[model samples]
Each structure stands twice: as C-alpha cells, then as structure tokens.
Target: MQAYRIVRDDLTQPAVLALLQFHLDEMNRWSPADKVHAMAAERLRAPDVTFFSAWDGAALASVGALRDLGAGRGELKSMRSAPDYRGRGAGRAMLDRLLDEARARGMTWLGLETGRPQAFRDAHALYAANGFAECAPFGDYVSDDFSLCMERGL
Candidate 1:
C-alpha cells in the first residue's frame, strides 16, 4: 500500500518493463498506431525525469513517472499496475505520489496521454476524478481519435 519514488535499477527494471509491455499489448489489441507507448524505464534513466514504484510489501504493484518539460510543465508517463492489483486503489496511490513529486520539483502543470479505448475506461475515470481535465495534445503527441489527453495544474 506504500508507494514512493525510486531510482531505475535492476530490482525495479523488470516490473517497469512488464508494465510497459502491458500498455503496449493493450494498444496492439485495439489499434497498433492508436497508442503511443513509450519506454518509461529508459526515459526515467534520463536526467530530467523522476520514476516511482509502488509496493505491497513483497511485490511491485504499480509504477509511474514524470518528465520535466521545463518552464513549470511536466508530462506523466509510464503508469501501470499489475493485473492482480488492478481496481485495488494502487493506480490512485501511484498518481498521488507522482503529483506530489511534480509539485516538489516546482512544476505548475502536469499532463498525460491515455488510450481512448474501452480498456482504458478505468484509467480515464481515475484521472478525471484526480482533478485532471481534458486538454489538447501536449509534448510530441498530436490530437487523434484514439488518444485522450488530460492536464492538471499543480
């Protein structure tokens, strides 16, 4: 139930990779080009990003990351929860932790991209409930029918 940020390392890499794969597979299952799946673990290894992992004592339950875009803006990336842990509030906890991290870093706004498919219904609801309002495309993403973008001011 405790979620926190950590370095990208051997112990955490596998879990992160699994989460990334889950997102990829979900996208492929719908429409391959519809989802913009990014390698979060690799991105976290960059100097301008912060990565977090959630653990339920013995295992990795979820993970999320934030990439600084400078000028007080940040993009949410690589969020995923283990299939066994879904619908148990792990995603919300991960998001709350990431938001706090964003604020601490002097970021005034945070944004994210999620699939617009039925499989992402829960994710869309979670973000909406967490104060993120639908927004136009940010980062390298362009507005598309299959992608939903949202943003929140810290």
Candidate 2:
C-alpha cells in the first residue's frame, strides 16, 4: 500500500483553502445551491469536527472530515483529493483514517450526503465499495432530487 500521513490539518494554508473551494465549486455545479451540503471552512474547524489532510512527502494529497453527531453517530464531510493526485490512494487513505477514528470513538453509525451528478459517479462507487448504502435522509437533511444520502453501521 502507498504510504501517506493523515494529519489534523488546518485551513490556514492557501493551497488547502483553494483546493477546498474547488471542491465546493464542483459540488455547486453538480447540485443546486440549496442542496449542497458541504460545510463552510469555518464550520469544518469546529470542536465536533475532525478535519484531516493527507500528505505524501511534502505534498498535500487530500482532505476529509468527520463530524460527531451525538449518540454514537458520525458524518463524513468535505472529502476531496487534489487534482494532481486524483487517481492515487489519497481518498482511500483519508477514508480509512476517518473510519478508524469513528470506530475508536465508539460510533455506532456513519453517514454522508453526496451529489448525484454524473461527475460524482466515482465518489458514489467509492462509498459503496466502502460499505455505505443508499438510505433516507438523516439528521437535518431532506429528500432532494440532486442529493444522495448513504449510511453504514459500524
């Protein structure tokens, strides 16, 4: 397996911010503005959210976050791989780290919201391959044509 460090990363770096903005912009393009569930940068830094960036050597390869939703539930948020590193293992590594974190925290379930545009097919496959299943909306989310809700029990 490829080796990369998944570290607790802050959004202070310009590159990180720019990459995250690109992720959000892509989401905006795929889904309606009202249906985009990506967390704002500031909110990603909140106490309940654990944000991480994957680093290969000195390069930031990807970013992801896990948010505690109380009562043993967790949510995956803001997963994005650097454009140059898209085909690499960054996304898988970040996801494994988040799953580890959630399991360590004794979370019973994990869930996420992702856009359903054709652009998101790879992401849909990734989540499904990782054991997520399509389900009704959870938490504050509502049914929407442009969004998909998925969950897996830990």
How do the predictions measure up, each by TM-score?
Answer: 0.86, 0.95
TM-score winner: 2
Q: What lDDT tens digits, residue by residue, belong to model 1 across residues 1-154? A: 4453333443256666777678667666775553656554556678777777787776777877888999999988878888877988788888888888889889999999887878789989999999998899987776577888899998
Instruction: Please list the residue runs of candidate 2 whose C-alpha ends up more than 4 Å from where it truly belongs after superposition.
Output: none
lDDT of 2 by residue, 53-91 (tens): 998888889999999999999999999999988878889
Cα lDDT for residue 55, candidate 1: 75
- Native-to-model Cα distance after best TM-score fit, residue 109 in candidate 2, in Å: 0.2
TM-score of 2: 0.95
User: Which residue pairs collide, candidate 1?
Assistant: none
Residue 68's lDDT within candidate 1 is 90
